[model samples]
Target: MTRQLRTGFLLALQFFSVIPVKKQLPMEKEYITAMYAILPLLGLLFGSVLTSTVWLLRDTTEISSLLLGFIVVLIGLVLTGGLHMDGLADTGDAYFSYQDRDKRLAIMGDPRIGAFGAMALVVAIVGKIILVAESINEASLVWVLLIPVFSRIGLLALFSFTKSAKPDGVAAFFQKRVSHKKLQLVAIVALVISFMLLIWSATFLSAIVLIILLFGFSWLYRAWCLRNFSGVTGDLLGAYVEGVEILLWMSLLFFV
Candidate 1:
């Protein structure tokens, strides 16, 4: 169990971020399930990096909020190596192609980006910048840290509840190995920890609103994925992560 948990943490870091993990690890069912189970902590790590960046920039520099927002977004892209963004682009292209399910999946598997993908990337990136610029402040840095946490929790919930669209790929492979009950337990614990963190920050109202919003969006996104793609894919999951992060940030604008 300890070895599975350790390898799972490394696997999550290796797969999701630019963080280097030199040693190769086994991808057994237990390890893969542990990977999904440990996924939200990956978000916590990202949140720490983002929060530290904001703190350093705000303390030392006089940059405009827009530039700060841009920097924050850039750091995210760098950290994840644009993995989720690529998923967002592929998802956009596939969904907007208006083709059959197989065709849409094929389109998503394509290396080239389409007009819709470009547009989706533009809209998502620009929207994030604007929302972050507007919402960020000293008092709200905690919210920024919590945003990725909630977004990842949403990702975990989506994965636990939804079936994979394809027979093969990262999403399908991991989904096949994961234990639904264990995944649910992890999601509950993550949510509880995040909620407590929010309350600790004295943003009790924000905590409630964010949890409600996360679950609502997760449900809607699952339905959308099932209807459009037959089920979720790695790209779809990535898109959900990106989409929920933005939504969470936007929601913070109301309170921050």
Candidate 2:
């Protein structure tokens, strides 16, 4: 059990970072569960950094809102190594490849960025910065951390429900091993914990809105994939996760 917990933690870290675990950690049913559990913990760490940065900037200089926003965004992208940025790029390439599903997926697999991909990356990053800068709320910044974590879980949901379109990739392994029951449990636990930890009001209104939006987006994406591709691929899953995160942030920013 101890070994499994360590392996799961490693897996979660690897999933979010460029660092690779050398050995094949034996997969247990709890591996995905652990990933879901550790997600908010990671979010908390990143949130702390951003929140600190924001407060420091607000205190340190009378920077214009536009400049401060840009700086905050720059710091965030640097911290994450622009992980979602890559996802946005890949997604744009795939979506605009002007080819068949296979060809589109192949485009996404390429390391090179196309014009469409570049535009998507610019829009997502800039849009996020603008929204965060304008809001200037500490709680809102903290909630932004959940964007990446929950979005990744949304990707994991796609993996659980669909098959890989190719023979090898990150999604391949997860798709092969992650089960429906495990994914469902992970989703339930993650959502519950998110609300429990994020509670700022007695009404729990914000949490309820977030829950509805997250599940609604997940189910809608699943249905769209079924109608179009018949199965989800690594690239498509990446796109879904990033897209969902962007929309989720937008919703939270405006609604909550």
Candidate 3:
């Protein structure tokens, strides 16, 4: 296969979802860099999968909204192999461990789960269900559809704007290759995506303001990651993604 098509944004889809793509052998950092260009689509694609299932459930089955929302969350977990969920857990354990930075980084590297990690996972999972269910009940399910997109927008921003904390972690490779120009392109991509998704929502004008606020909120977390962890890591990226997901849903609860 040609390099352009082979290494294209398909890498992002494969990286973040269960969906298969023709991955070129010996993956290149360039592929990853290129993938960041379309990160919003990754979220949009995932959200499409979610909303498709939701439509099926609502139209064909008699499932309770809360239960259906729970099921949707489960489908998401399966689709992403609980990718960000694991990050959320590890981040929780490491950050709340109260160890010095070095020790905390080491704790994050360990394979075993800590109490804080497990608690974080439980809270995130349950919280997502409640928020999504509320959206479903309000017939504002469109918000859920776009949340995966918004969460990814937040993730892409986090990845582009921050340095990596660990030299050898997965995030480090991309950090090294990402240029100032590339980051500028990525920010534009994210803004365009935000506008597209926001304008289509139920409350159009308020969505414009809300999305700007959301982006601002994500930037604050980027600062926090730098201050707390020294920079971003793969685990930290995942935690940010999950956090943005919840924040978007919660914000919608008030706005939608």
Candidate 4:
């Protein structure tokens, strides 16, 4: 494939729910840079789809809030194909089992979900359902849009600061593919856009608080990883995404 076509393909694979581009693109710098660009765009795409779904359900029929929330969940699952869900499951299985660092890393790489993963998945989904039900608003939904984008942006911090505990897998691909300078640039852009979105949504203060909290959590995550596993993994990135999204909603719901 031409470089441009390959780059676009990589972005599509990394970012969008539509057009499932199956083959993994070459782990090039351009491909990795495209990932940061593509990642936030997925948030925008999902948010737009979500807003439309809510409007359609609200307008076309008398959908109950509970049912609507379920639909929203399904839409998210379909969009990302449960990518983050898998992350949550893996992280939970690894973290909560009280396994040693090497064992935890090994378990995280396992495809099978354990009892801890199952429970964590249930809790995370239920929490999302409740939050979506309560926070369903045109404005709030717009802020809800921030969850995926910022979560992926937050992934960059993990990639930037920590070593990959595993020598192989998705984490290795990203670490090899993306450079520090490119990751930093993408993060700055994502954060600036995030702040602007917050301002636009009239939640500027909440946005600031959220960023600080994200950094704080990132530090804690890093420390925990070092103490236990000695470095971060793909599952940890997934956990970070879900945890941060939950915290963001909880903060916005109660504090903002």
| lDDT ranking from best candidate downward | 1, 3, 4, 2
| C-alpha lDDT (0 to 100) for residue 219 of candidate 4 | 84
Top candidate on TM-score is 1
Q: Candidate 4, residues 142-206: lDDT per residue as tens digits?
A: 57577767776777767777888888866766777666786678678888988788777766677
TM-score of 1: 0.96
lDDT of 1: 0.87
Residues 47-81, candidate 3: write the lDDT tens digits.
Answer: 88888888889768988979987998898898888
Candidate 1 residue lDDT tens string, 1-256: 8888999999888888898999888988888888888878888889899999998887678878899889999999998989999999999999999999999999999989999999999999999998888777644667778777888888888888888899987788888888988998899999999889888885678778878888898999999999999899989999998999898888876754
Clashes of each: 0, 0, 0, 0
Relative to the true structure, candidate 3 reaches a TM of 0.90
- Candidate 1 Cα errors over 4 Å, as ranges: none
Find the 10 residues in a row with the least total lDDT in model 1. Answer: 135-144
Model 4: colliding residue pairs: none
How far in Å is the alpha carbon of 115 misplaced in model 1?
0.9
Candidate 2 lDDT (Cα, 0 to 1): 0.67
TM-score of each: 0.96, 0.80, 0.90, 0.87
lDDT of 2 by residue, 1-256 (tens): 6765677778766666444667666566667566544554555565577667777776677877667778867766665566767867987887777678778767878999999999998888788777666655534554655655566556656666676666676666665565567666666676666677557532377777777888899889877666555567655665675577667657755666
RMSD of 2: 3.2
